[model samples]
Target: MDTKRIFRDFNHCKFLVFTCLLPAELFVSLYLDSVINWSLWLVLLPIWTLKVLVIAGALVGTIVWCHKPFRRNEADGFTDFKAMLITVGIQVLLLLFELLLCNKIESNSPISWILVFTPMYLVSTLSIGACIWGYKNARSTELESLISLNTLLFVFVSLKLHNVIHWNWSVIFIPLWIIMCLPTIVVLHHLWTLAFLRSNFHGVDKQSLVLDTIMWIAIDVPLLTFEILLASRLDQQNDISWVNIFIPLHISLLGLIWSTFGRKGGNTWWFGLREDFCTIFLRICPFMRLYGNVECKEREGGDGSEIMMMPVVTQVVCKSPSKCEPVVAVTHIATPD
Candidate 1:
């Protein structure tokens, strides 16, 4: 009966599903590339499928918005609409870059790596500006660090690919190494805070602290391992199997998906779709109807001549405590006939 709770759960569920699918697809693509000589497009089929679904959902949402009978009470509907458009545009841009990169890699095209990565450069530039705006507005700038480091990594990659830099692949990956070290700093801070709280005789949420620490370790350790293995493999410093190299990545992705399950609500572009899916699912699920607390049932009237569906309340008490005794009560909602 709590619509807000239902919507919140739906958003969390959507995040869980996306986290599972997207990373799984990427890992599978990596695995396939190592095993088979499949075409890049074919290997990327799952990603394309997800993109198609997203674009289709956007179109459907746009159509429904244009023809809807009533306007939403809050302004979020319009904001979500704009967000959907932006998401689609970004998806298209990333897809363009992927296609170009794939073509260059597959056919040994003359297209420069810088040209292939232009879309990512543009995205990173926009992300920098967004991060600046966010910092000005007192929003989190943690993501800005990652974005800047990634952009630097991209530059290092392009230079290495173009033979403009003869540095070792591990050296080229210094930015990513720094990125990974950030979590180490955060974990150390958390430990320090915990120790301070304990030393001061302050109440500590040990359960939450333990869970947070475990989650950080689960995600970061595997992620760091994956990066190390990848860098070593790229540099031919190690002859580890590709499957083994990707195992840590798979573990990290699983940790990400697990974290999403424990997360609560936040604004996501699929908010409307999640709500619609939740509603339809509840309607079709018989067990949900059977177990739900709220429902309308037919009751015979006093004369036994009419049946009506009404909202019923039980265990009512008089507002004035002295006027009446507390007793079981049934209040019927009247209906116009």
Candidate 2:
């Protein structure tokens, strides 16, 4: 067999299979331990250790595969290593936290903070890092699309975990997470769109934006519905009432509306629509008065730009024409002009 063919086979067979199976296995172990009340270390530890070993083996395999005397420049040493390390590190951290710590605690342990918090932190960090690198290095629409989807998954997963562990049940956080997701999501959308648009113009035969739009709506609508349903079901334990349903309902409706109308022409309708509605609703909805004036702005430079630009201020009032309240801003300066 040829060396290149051998490398390709190893990547497909060993690395890919290990990467996919490790997560599935870990999640299965977690479900058994948490929801099913199975033994933790006895059933999961060996598998978890194997996952680590497989990942290590994959990393080593990838290195070996890249090593060729004649194909020195073919290897992206630091970049490939960094990417693999970050990804593997996050998976390992998640396994340790969800499998080891989450199971061990009869009650939430403050000292076990490392296991609880580290996964979210590391996953978020790696995701943001990968997104930044992908934005810079990813040369194809398919790769960029995959990265974008992964980034959204990361955000959703991280936020979901945070809410499950730390956040209280409130409609407030639903909008808050959506707000948090806006900028990164927008950037991802823009990249995916631009890549395809450019490909189309260049006659590279990319996927259709219309089809992409439809596919996005199709996937998002069902997923959002499921999320709302899950949220509603979870909320039943706490506040099983119409008011409790409002959050998830609003979330689902807004998501559908946004996907249909807001995301029309591949531009976000959230900020503008929110502003218009808030402007109108503020007159009728007395609670809207509590929100004060929110001004979204974007910052230049740093990894902060990669995830979403940080909200400079949360709550403040607009005193005058020159004065504006601080809000979460999605700046697209880093995006190609």
Candidate 3:
């Protein structure tokens, strides 16, 4: 798993933090704030912890790099350092936004919604610039789409909150609805394939297909349900409790947490970072080995030393003494020396 490089790589550490802490934080904060009436600061401690750690690390890295730049890889080091500063800047902006939001929610602060959302507006503006630059450089445009939609959603929400627009909560959430339907469409396609095209697959392939389809449903269904419930509650369309509306969100967060630990801890399409914390964690707590068999198989395949310890036996067919019957006998056994 290259445990040595896991912590050294910035992206790996970022992935590890998000995968382990983010979902759990969401669930905990939502539950505590909605049910227990906890202070926003206490409920958001996890986020604060993560932000502090990230900012501290970035500061330390920047200082170290400035003091003694990498002689052999100076260009890469400078580039990474620049990226780290940019990332920390973004985090600081987000923290500011959160502070404004918390103040508004808790103390009934008189900050205008537009003023509170200034950080986001800046981010979106930068994102638009990034999208343009990326397009010119033949890079991905996915971020542009997300930023655009989120900007629209934010504007709609701000208007709704300020009574500037007399739009229903459901109408204000059209961007989210659009986003959710994209994945729902994907899941529906998988279901259709599973129902009608099942004959074309077999064995492990079929099992994998089914598992993937199930995972998609497990994540998407809860998210869709939660969004619908939240909108309904906001619009006073239903008397469902806040806790009830968040139950589906809790489920989805749990699924995300499970997926983080279940899958091989490495770079992926969704999370392009690698860390061995999950592997180490599973080993330390033996009773929590939900995917033990898979881990064992991965370990066996990943290293040749483990495979060399097994004994090899060869079977030979020999004729029996009295009857014209063939008997099987072990001819040789090869063991590790």
- After best superposition, candidate 1 residue 147: deviation in angstroms? 3.8
Off by over 4 Å in 1: 1-34, 69-75, 132-149, 193-204, 265-337
> Which residue pairs collide, candidate 3?
none
lDDT of 3 by residue, 1-337 (tens): 2222222222444345556455545656466446566787777777788778777777666566555544315433443444455456666777888888889888988888878888878766666765675566544445345665588788788777777899899999998998888879988988887787656455535655776687778879998999898889888898887666777777776665544433432221112111134444434554433222211112232545443222222221122234332223233333444
> Order of all candidates by TM-score, from best down to worst?
1, 3, 2
Q: List the RMSD of every prediction in angstroms.
A: 12.3, 23.8, 12.3
Strongest candidate by lDDT = 1
Regions of candidate 3 where Cα sits further than 4 Å from its true position: 1-34, 71-83, 129-148, 193-207, 261-337
- TM-score to true structure, per model: 0.70, 0.41, 0.65
Query: Model 2 over residues 1-337: C-alpha lDDT tens digits?
Result: 1121121112221223334444444444355435445554444554566566647655664555455333223335344444445556655766656664645454455544444555655566565566677568652222223433454444544456555455443452465346436444754684577565753376433434554455455445444554554455555654444333334334433343433322212101111121223234444554443334333344556655443333333343323334443444343424343
lDDT by residue (146-193, candidate 1, tens digit) is: 555599888889889888899998999998887778888877877776
Better of 1 and 2 by TM-score: 1
Clashes of 1: 0
Model 3 vs truth, CA RMSD: 12.3
lDDT of each: 0.63, 0.44, 0.59
Worst 10 residues of 3 by lDDT: 266-275
What's the C-alpha lDDT at position 214 in model 1? 75
